[model samples]
Target: MKKQVLSYWLKDSQKKTYPRLEKNLNVDILIVGGGITGILCAYQLAKQNKYRIALVEKNRLYHSTTGFTTGKVTVQHDDIYHQLIKNKGETIARAYYQANSEAVQGLKKIVEEENIDCDWVDTKAILYAFSEEEAKRLQREQNAYDTLGIPYEWLDKETLPFQTLGGLAIPDQGVFHIVRFLDGILNNLNVDIYEKTKIIKTNPTEKGAVAETADHYKISAKHIVLATHYPIYKRFNFYFTKIKPTCSYVAIAHEFAIKPENAYINLIDPVLSIRFLDSADPKLMVAGFGHDVKNYYSYLDQIHKLKAMATERLGAKDFTEEWYNQDYESMDMVPLIGKITDAPLYLATGFRKWGITSAFVASLIIKDLIEGINNQYAYLYDPNRNKNTFKTVCYNFAMLSTVIKTKLLTVPKSIKINPGNGRIIQHKGSKIGLYIDQNGKTYSVKPICTHLGCTLRFNNVTKTYECPCHGSRFNYDGTSLDGPAVRNLTQL
Candidate 1:
């Protein structure tokens, strides 16, 4: 039997591909990503018809992070309120909760008004604990919720398949089919959409910015939005240093015996998120086991661990679909959603795996910033907010350490690399990435990241060269897959 590699969401829904940019055209705003954040921003701006809006996507719409998400639309982000209250303040913490809660309500209103049947379901979001330490953290989160005047329920017993010490439940949180929801909005909007349109670079003009595509087509717009998962431009913002990329695995199993009443996440080390999709046949999606992308020895091993957990603990006979998702977490924990250093180029990223609500919040903030409307939550997610120097210093140190390790590590001299496998080895006094196909054809490239010159490591499961410094990924043939890295690895 063939392995299921795509997400259940993508498998069940019909995906619409758009035309690529064949000619250079000017627009008032040019959004450079087609994920939920970019699409929603385009939808909001295009609905007004005040300006000509164009969205350009490097790949299919919603095929990236948005499509791979577990589709939980909740504000409860893994015992975050307690830390927010402690680190930032009660006011900021309350504002964070309020922003996300408002985003949920806003999305709900849109679904209802538009009659979007994206399997929208309103349910409580529960954060449970398995250990005493986690339980205490949950208590602190509950206290923070109370101080913020947010309504929640403290539960000792729940309908979850497994046992938990206790949990905090925030009502009215939601889960939905992300692609379908975005499709509903996209269908109703008038924005010019382009797919397979890779923006190679963006140059700031006196009036606005000019985005140059890989095909040499130039799009001049009054404003630009870098809604790509990772900001392609690195010089101005230094998002590569600020945001740390982590990859998580998810598996979906059909006919789950024990379905919880609400969306669930745990407070354990390897956090597990649970949600159910009620379509023609019910399916349970389990997501967790996140780690730094470079730290994993093998992506297949990580997937095996996730699969074992699901099969043993959740009574899943087998997974109908399985895939991995990547997310960037900011050093300060808050998402960076605003202008990139007073430039007309705006950015929205570092959602830390909780992008469903963060993306909506980002769309609102970016829309307001562009239209000169005052959004109160803008300050909380500013890209150039006051730096937590200690955290920033630590993050930079870690990145530097990874770079040093990658550069200094000795490569194997005469290792036999098997087919369907990849490795970095020393060749001609320099590191080279080598991969052999099942048919015994060999491909090699310089094992250096195109983003920042960090040494690249081979990801055995995905068969890609991944950067340890900033999570840029490249195909075995040296084509760029994900960024921070815009350029492909140098072919040897």
Candidate 2:
């Protein structure tokens, strides 16, 4: 069998192209980033028949987390309601529940209204636990559901091959081809889209704001939304301190005997989330064994355990596709949406691997905020909510520890790097990241993050240099692949 190290969704789909921004333009609303949040924000705003909106993406659509997501359209995000209620207030937690639930309906309604050809499948979203401790936690979450008036059913049994204590089930959840759904929306959206247009920086003006592209083209708008998953702006909102980024992996198994009627994720560490694709080709997708982005290739072997799990439980015989994706989560788990520091500039992020409904929720909130309408969930998802300062301080301290450890360890070490492999070495008192390709071509780059000067770690599997502090990633040739790091590594 053939093997692909790309997302099965990306590997199997047709890509749509948009023109890059070549000159300065002015619009009423300028949306930065083209992930689901940005696209959906544009979609919602366009529906009002107001605002001259232009959506700019650094790369083509579906080339980011929007394409690599697990693609489940459910409101169940692990077992988060209980935590939300505890950390945030009941009002915020309840609002989050209602927003996400409504988002699911909104997505389904769009599919029905547009008669989109995306493979939509309705299924129960279930959460199973193997330990008694986890089962008790599920009961507590069930209590939270009761308090919030959310409907759920008790799951006394599990269909999986492993022994489970008990689980909870939420009905009316669904799954679909996320890319196809977006494509369907894009076909009808009356918005200008520019791919490969990187907005390097944004400056505040008295009237509104102006965003400068990497090519020195400016887009002046009354409002600019930084829907980039990780806020590319380094210092403005200070999101880097609260947000945590991770590198997660997924594998698809074909011809699997186990077919589930619902989406399932366990209450366990190194979480195991399972879903299916039912269409011309039926397959099982197992995801969620990840580490901090800084760990990179060090913890990549965890995905192998997830594969062995599918092989054991589902009788998965053919594993053809495996890939890695990045996710950003807030320390408090609730997503961040709305204006950045009360400016016309906005952001929606910290989806925590549940971007489907969260993105819709963001679009709704952002649209309302822009229209000057008070959305019920607006304050709950606001990016400006003042919370614990200790969490921020602790996060930054850990970041500082990473910096110290990296710099102290970067002494001169003579090493022989083989072809098809890479290593960091001290060259004239400066750390240099070196990667040798299969053909013996060498690629050299400064081993430092452009965002915060953090030491960059190399991922052998994905062939990218990743930053732990802010989750910036670069390709082997020193090209920026992901952000909070908008700048590429320096060639050395």
The best candidate in terms of lDDT: 1
Per-prediction TM-score? 0.94, 0.95
Q: Clashes in each model (backbone N, CA, C under 3 Å)?
A: 0, 0
Structure candidate 2, residue pairs in collision: none
The residue-by-residue lDDT of candidate 1 on 186-280, one tens digit each, is: 77889899999999999788899899999999999999999999987645747777888998998887746676458888877667778888756
lDDT of 2 by residue, 42-83 (tens): 999999997899999997786888889889998898889998
- Could you tell me which 10 consecutive residues in candidate 2 have the lowest summed lDDT? 291-300
Output the lDDT of residue 377, model 1: 99
Assess candidate 1 and give its lDDT: 0.85
